[model samples]
Target: MSNSRSTKLHVAIFPCFAFGHITPYLQFSNKLAKRGHRVSFLLSKGAQAKVEHLNLYPNLIHFYPLLVPSVDRLPPGAEATSDVPFPLHGHLCIAIDQTLDQVQTVLSSLKPDFIFFDFSLWMPALAHQTGSKAIYYSVITPVAQALKVPSKQKPEDMTLEDFMQLPPGYPSSSVRIKSKDFETAQLKVVANDLGTGMSIYVRITSSMIWSDAMAFRTYHEVEGPYCDYLRKHYGKPVLLTGPVLPETPATKLLDEKWTNWLCNFKQGAVVYCAFGSQNKLQKDQFQELLLGFKLCRQPFLVALSTPDGCATIEEAFPEGFEESVKGRGWVYGGWVPQTLILEHPSIGCSVTHCGYGSMLMVEELKVAVEVEREDNGWISKESLSKAIISVMGEDSEIAGLVKYNHAKLKEELTSEGMQERYLGTFIQNLQGLLD
Candidate 1:
């Protein structure tokens, strides 16, 4: 280890075995590598292959593929959570758990200054054994963590009522789980007992308690109170990386097919819709969503996974869906360049499932509206159409207000030196920990 503060640090990153997790970790790695630090990214072989193209600084950021051991119920060659359905994700966690020895061996050899990880509760101990500091880096929002502060009470003892109630001294009243959504909240918060024989609550809390420091992919301006709550509860340094969005490679280009198709629409005339890769809607709900797009009567593009029980998007399409929206609507069942599409001049509004990042935009920032769901937790086509209209209608006041707010927020986030300042402070904190 070097004595000076300016000396480059070696950092290791091993996030949970999901693309949702891996993608963020890799983005963080890119930031570190951009700052002239050496980063060793520990992940499964398959995950490495899938994200190899995303490694912008291959010279400084290295991939060390861990050999995921065989586990019963985990399909052959399945290394990441995306390789199988959600229910089988537990088995993937088990496989990841089995890689602890491999990770330790690599850590010992590399002798990094710090290791950043989530989900692997045993990582802090390994880091200690290898003379490295552990940073429990959470990709989840601090607001969510603050809602369900971990307790010594076992998972079996926790009730839905327990989860519904926010933690003492919780921060925001605007960000809350409604009583109707208590069951879903409970399932996500404490009931998630993965294949490692540990609930997600226990895994995260234990990791946070043991790690040398904690980090989040957010800044204080966004979630200051929630971050403070975690810092006070855990009594550890809570560092922020801001939003570590990866810089697009100069050589990368949007696919020609997408470019050609989007060119047909006028400026700011098309609505783009996509749920995340992991979200597979039921057949009925899928058709309802497509019908909602048709009801909106606007040019739209939908890139989503095939609906459950259907082999292809075409098979699940509503009767005459293609005919009703010919030349205007396109439904694709594969990945597209999302960032590029969002930047396209032809795109006006986006309909999403409110994944972690976008949820803040809808709920807290008030830059987007959520489609109302029925008591049965299903969204009606009319509700979706109404939400789209509220944001897209030229004369609508809500549309104008949200658009102005979104533009202001975007400008602040992308302003010169904003990201640099966050990353600079983050690196200083890491060095301070070592000192």
Candidate 2:
């Protein structure tokens, strides 16, 4: 079982048909390539185009496109989940499922040593057929994954109570879903049959059971207990990649328009809000979010998708809202350079949807505050304003504490050799598994 210490492995990554998932896989691929390994990134043709610029090491990491087969109800030429609405996502999954034979063909030809994948339950079997090892690479947090582990009971037969119950040997109780979120959690468990006759729970659990090993884009310091719980539950090794973030390209520059607009504000004076791609709020909720920024009475920039059924952000604004906040606030409907915006000196607080990854920051690291939601799961403008001010307020103790803790944790995560050490161990584990 001994492997040459200098051996360079070939790895293939096939993430789900979503930008959030695809982006992380590419980041991880960059990490692997940086370490002198070759990577074949398998994705849909359309998806490949969107993320091509992110392939930092094109020579070492190649993009291999797969043709997405036509499925009923999926928009013509829609390959990734971002191309269509949320309801049509299941059909997209069906389309991805139909590409299994095509993937098998590619894998057989490449014959990579390892194939990293998520959401494709058939990958393990195909990898075995192609003489490759399948690693279940999850972009989501281990806390969420551990919570959603499939039970012995059938998915359709599971109730809200059963869905709320934490998996046996789960490490943290505070991280469990709130009562208000139970309905959404229930749907994920019982009604997430992604048009492939397999619930999400089934897809995840099956992937875990069949994959050669499980991998995560996290470090032991952040998720050690959850990783341990998963390892014990699945009887397999769990590899950690320590948040595989690619170095920002030097050639990439922030657009001048954003730079000019942000310079109008003082240092740490602007509240920047962005809900990641795929979170389209209803028109009313979107307007409420805008009004919340107005209520905060601070300089702000909001970059969000036009709300559902709204053609433009202007039309969705509340009455007099445009004029009232014209000088100090800007609402943009298109994508902005989020990383640069966050790095900008004037940008103060970031309001986000608290996606799976950020949940750890709020719940575990205590680096951010959660905006209180109404009974119906909608965030009121007042609540949103309060949350923003709490962090941005000059005299707020919570803001000071969060900033200190966040800075301390950021230093630890970004310390010299932190990522390299984690990645080195991870690569060693990957080689060990093949031994």
Compute each candidate's TM-score over C-alphas: 0.95, 0.95
> What local lDDT does model 2 show for residue 76?
94
lDDT of 1 by residue, 126-192 (tens): 9999999999999888877777675434534555566666666777767656665524753564655
| Candidate 1 wrong stretches, greater than 4 Å | 1-5, 151-157, 181-190, 355-359
- Output the number of the TM-score-best candidate: 2
lDDT of 2 by residue, 1-435 (tens): 357768899999999989989999998999889889999989999888888988889999998899999999888999877688877888888889998888888889999999999999899999999888999999888987777665654444545565667767678877756566634654464446766676766777778888999999888888899899889888899999998766788888778999999999999999999887777889999999999999999999999988888888888999999999988999998877888889899998888876445667888888999888765678899999999999988899999989998899889889999999999989888899887
Q: Give residue 344's lDDT in candidate 2 (0 to 100).
A: 92
Query: Looking at candidate 1, what is the lDDT of residue 374?
Result: 77
C-alpha root-mean-square deviation, each candidate = 1.9, 1.8
lDDT of each: 0.86, 0.85
